[model samples]
Target: MAEKVTAYRFDRIDETLSQLNREDCAIIAGGTDVMVLHKSRRGVPPKFSKPIVFIDHLSELKQVYQTDKDLHIGACCTYTELLEHPLIPTPIKSAIKTIAAPAIRNRGTVGGNICNASPAGDMLPLLYVYNAKVLLRSVNGDRFVAISDFIQGPRRIQRLHNEIVTEIILPSVLEEGTHVIFEKVGNRNADAIAKVSFAGFMRINKERIEDIRFAFGAVGPTMIRSREIEKKLVGKTLPLADAEIDTIVAEFDKIIRPIDDQRSTAVYRKTVALNLLRYFLSLKQ
Candidate 1:
């Protein structure tokens, strides 16, 4: 005999939170990754083992609004919705456009993507570069955590079982003349999981590199970014000398640790990550 499953649907945030606080339940929004896990029987803490609380229909978690300093994205907002919204940053838009296909994008929520915490999750690298924050709400209160801190490991996060991610906050203004790039290599073009992915933002002023941020995914336990490496090139002049480029590439090679898996080899992922970074930097000239 199989275990019986119980499901609860709530249209209000408070009601959902109350249920979450009182019972041991899994909170589900888009059900994209969760469903796959439930069907495949893979991953830690097997899916559908406990009661489920569905919050996807709550209007409170489906909004996209902005303030003077930040843009607030609701937890249940879908990728297609974000892509269609004018307030979404261009870099973010570029990245979201590459997720799955139209049908999957229509049902896949940004919050779900973040909470799923896949190493190759397309949204995370951009969020990491943007210095995004996640807002978690529980019956007890609310808490905010940096994107970097929120994701503890592959398929692991800081969110308590009783808390729900309510919003994702990002800076409203990015540096002027910043160039952003998002690149991914997968088994196929559409709907395929990434073998390796990279997102970069750089700004050059007067032929001198003013600011730079780089993130690589599916090459580490979590999305990879190094402030130490970024600091080294911040004030350097562009049209970088071959020696300088080699030095930066060497540093990146040291940091990116990949593993051979079903999708790709460790060697292939590391090679592509470095190549993409080199190509992105070359575009600044």
Candidate 2:
């Protein structure tokens, strides 16, 4: 008879990460992606070997804080937690709460969503639009990486195996007329991954746009912040003629590149993204 592999849980991040660094153990969070990968024998080790270190109990990673200057969300804050956090701005809370179902949202950590490095990850586009930062730590020390630069490609990242993501930092977005919006185009809007998703930030000054930030996900190799499109919208006021809106729409089309995948066709994704852009721009409520 073969020996059965047992799972382990870590109560402290520093202690567990240090041990895992020495032993090269497998890390598990929600076990959403890990279990599937193991079952399929795709990339992860089988259940019979490598010790599994679960970090779900790290209380330090489950907090959300807001100061006059910034918002700090601990790495293990689950989607359900974020949805309920009083400091998470309304639009962001609304967007993330709708991801998958209640059960998955309850278990999926925001850090896992990021460290997993999936382009289609629901929380990523929102992170990009908010100018979030990822805090990483290892036995060596701590470092911060911009969310925009953290994810390198589909299922790839710059995160070293020895490093653990400790926190996510978001600057305060509390302001009058600070319009933030998120859009996702999916087949059924039920357990559907984003065929294409976008998030935008706008601050209105008088009758004009003061600042703008735009981002898109599930359409490229990684979630992207489109500074070029954002630049075009900044200082541009609404109630403009049809021609100006048309020009802006054309510019948006140039920034996003959608590809065909199991969930949707390339053409459909592109068209839907453009339509959503128009819809978001036209909204006042």
Candidate 3:
């Protein structure tokens, strides 16, 4: 026999939080990930120990607004929503377009992606490099956490039972002339999970490297980034020598730890990742 699951639906954020405070509850926004994650076999209900609060329809969780310093994206906003919104950065749109086909994009929310915390999650590498922040809300109040700190490892996150990630904050401006490269090595062009992915941002001013950032996914426990290595490239003039590129790639090679998974092998992922890094650095020449 299946135990009955209690599901709560609210039209307002405050009401949702009020209900959430009475007991530990799981939040469902864009239930796409949750449904698949908790799917059961042959019509049998998967065991769910926590009550569920459905906030997908709440307006509070579907907004996109910008302040002087940041672009605020409601956690429930779907990939399609962000794609259509003009304020979304090019890098974000580039990454979102690579996600599953239209059906999944229409239903999948970035917030769900953040909470899932998969190493291959398409949004993670971009978010990590963007210096994005995740906002978690509860009856107590609101809290913001750096994306890197919020996502510890595969399927691991820092959310409390009472907290729901309500919004994502992104910087309002990307420096002009920034070159962004986002590549996903997948089996197919569309609707394929990334075997390995890389997102690199570089800005060159008068042939001098003004800023550079590299983040790799599916190659580490969390989105992998090294501030130390990025600092080494700052102010270095472009048309870098082969030896310079090799040195940077070698440094990244040491940190790009991958594992053999059903989707891909460790060696393949590592090789593709380094290749992508080399390609990103080869942009100017």
Candidate 4:
């Protein structure tokens, strides 16, 4: 017979961290993904045999606030909550709005999305463009890590077993005149996983690119961001000549090596990723 699962819920962060330190357990906050995996195991052996510790009710992990420099979003804040919140940046709002459907959005937490670490996750590319940082906590203490460093690969992260992500920190506001864009290609408009996605932020002053960043999703083991490529574009003038665009496109071709997956072909994803960048450039032209 399979071992029965047990659940523990706590209202205090300290108590939760103490329990995690004492025993092995699986952390669940917004059972959106966890419950699906559990229910799908019909006859198959369960992947998780440990007890579950529920943190969805922890008030400490559900806040959305701002400081002088950054906005802090608690890990348990759901996609629905982000949509309703006034402080969410335009690019992030645009990206999160494309996630699943209304019901899943209501139940899915930002931390759950980050911890799940799906390469196709809609929020990741936005987080990358914003240079967000994740705050993690444990019985020992707390630490902050950049979004890129926090998520090492698909379904893998640097978070320790006893640590829980408490919040994400992002710039309180983008600079004036900055333009942000998010583009996604999927099988369906709603409730569909991304075949390829792109998120970009750029600021132009006097017809010259003052700052810029780009992130691509569902095209690799992890979301792709290239500071080297971004550097080449920053300080360059807008309306890039065809030759310059071709050079940049060729550089991107070398960076992304997608593999054929159930949702899309590698060729299609690669082509779309490049085209998305081209489209963003066109917007400025």
Candidate 5:
């Protein structure tokens, strides 16, 4: 029979890092994902190691605030907390509602989702649209990493062994005349992983476009911000008399590289991505 597991909790990152660097430790946040892994025996549980660090109790990283210029979301905040926060961006709030079941949302955290770096992670596309920055801390020091750079590949990140994400920072909100949209094609209407997700926001200047952001998820190794697509849309009115909507759709098709998977086929994801882009453009009307 297996021996009972042991666990440790800390109120700080430095103290936890010191413990982790010396012994095998499983990082536990919301435990939504980790619990499943543990039940499945996928990894060594905390009890199996000499010491395990529980970071969910670090109150220093539990702050959720917004300044006139930016929104600061603590890494320890749960999805339900984000959904209930009054200052959260409307687009983000809406997206969080569709993330998972109520039970999962109640226990799942934004930091864990981001750190997991899953391509189908529900909030990642929203983070990309806002150009979110991740704050990471370790025993050595602190540093900030952009979400685009923090995620390296499928279920991977650039996080160091001792580093823990402290918070996510979003730039100040945009003014009026800026439209935002997030659309995803999932298997079911509720609690479904995105087959292909697209998120975009743009500032329209009279008949022209000033700034635009586009992000696609579950289509590549990571949720990607399409600078190429944004560059093409900037300074130009979409669905213009000169540029047809079909042309913009075609451009998006070329920008994303999707693969055939169990949930969806490459051809279908590409087609859905184009349709989602068109739907976003229509919202500007």
Candidate 6:
């Protein structure tokens, strides 16, 4: 058996940051992913090589607010909380609904999903399409990074040992989207991990595509989103939608690099991804 790790819970943010300098310590909130990764036998406590600092109880890190330019979702906010909040947009709510069962959603958190850095994380594709950013903090100071840059690759994040993600920031303009769509393909309807998933949104005005976004999960090192590629459809008229859809699909195909995993094959993922893109485009009409 591994040595039992100590757990710390602090009500104050200041007290939490004071203990964050140690490289051997881990930060945990919902324990949704952490507990699974450090699992032991069925009847045994989870095996841990480092101590855990629980921050879910900190009220300072559970805020949800909006400013002139952005919606700030605190790191400790759970999936259930966001689902119930009236301010959350349809695109985000749709994605969160497909995550897991009610019990897991009640405990799993937004920050946990982001920091876990899994390419298949359901929330990631929407976060990428919505122009989200992550707020990282430490005793030294605070900094914000684009979500695309923060989650470097599968199971990898750019956070330092001393830094903790305090919030997930999204552009306020996302709430005004004219249409939104989200879909996750998994083996089972409940508690299944995504084999391929997509989150997209667009605003049409006077029969012209004013704005559009697309992001795909479980099909790349990180969730695949490219602003340069999405520009192809923006400002296009509805009459040109059919032809443009094929062009957009081809553009995305070049960047969606998947690999064979226990859950799925690369070819199946790529085929379904492009098909979903086609279905999403068809809806634009």
Against the hidden reference, what TM-scores do the models get?
A: 0.94, 0.90, 0.95, 0.94, 0.89, 0.95
Q: How many Å off is the CA of 175 in candidate 6?
A: 3.3
**On residues 162-252, what C-alpha lDDT tens digit does candidate 3 reach at each position?**
7889999987456576777789988998888789999998878888988888899998888899999999999898888899999999999
- Candidate 1: regions farther than 4 A off: 1-3, 40-47
Write candidate 4's Cα lDDT for 3-90 as tens digits.
6768799879899999999887889999887776666356754456788999989999999998986999999999999999988776
lDDT of 1 by residue, 48-103 (tens): 87899988899999999888869999999999999999888887888887879899
- Compute the lDDT for candidate 3: 0.87
Which scores better on lDDT, 1 or 3?
1
Name the TM-score of candidate 3. Answer: 0.95
Q: Which candidate order results from sorting by lDDT in descending order?
A: 1, 4, 3, 6, 5, 2
* lDDT scores of the candidates, listed in order: 0.88, 0.79, 0.87, 0.88, 0.80, 0.86
Candidate 3, residue 113: lDDT: 89
Residue 238's lDDT in candidate 1 = 81
- What TM-score quantifies how close candidate 6 is to the native fold? 0.95
Where model 6 places Cα greater than 4 Å from the true spot, the runs are none
Candidate 6 C-alpha lDDT tens digits along 1-285: 546668888778877888887554788889999999888888788877778899888887789888976899999899999999877776678778878989999998899999999989989988887789999988999999999999998789999888889999998554444777889999998799899999887788877888888889999889888889878788887756566778888888898888899999999999999998888888745
Least accurate 10 contiguous residues by lDDT in model 1: 38-47
Tell me the lDDT of model 4 at 220.
97
Lowest lDDT 10-mer window, candidate 2?
A: 40-49
The TM-score obtained by model 1 is 0.94
The local lDDT score (0 to 100) that residue 7 gets in candidate 4 is: 77
Name the runs in model 3 displaced over 4 angstroms: none
Error of 2 at 165 (Å): 0.8
Worst 10 residues of 3 by lDDT: 171-180
lDDT of 2 at 256: 72
Error of 5 at 41 (Å): 7.0
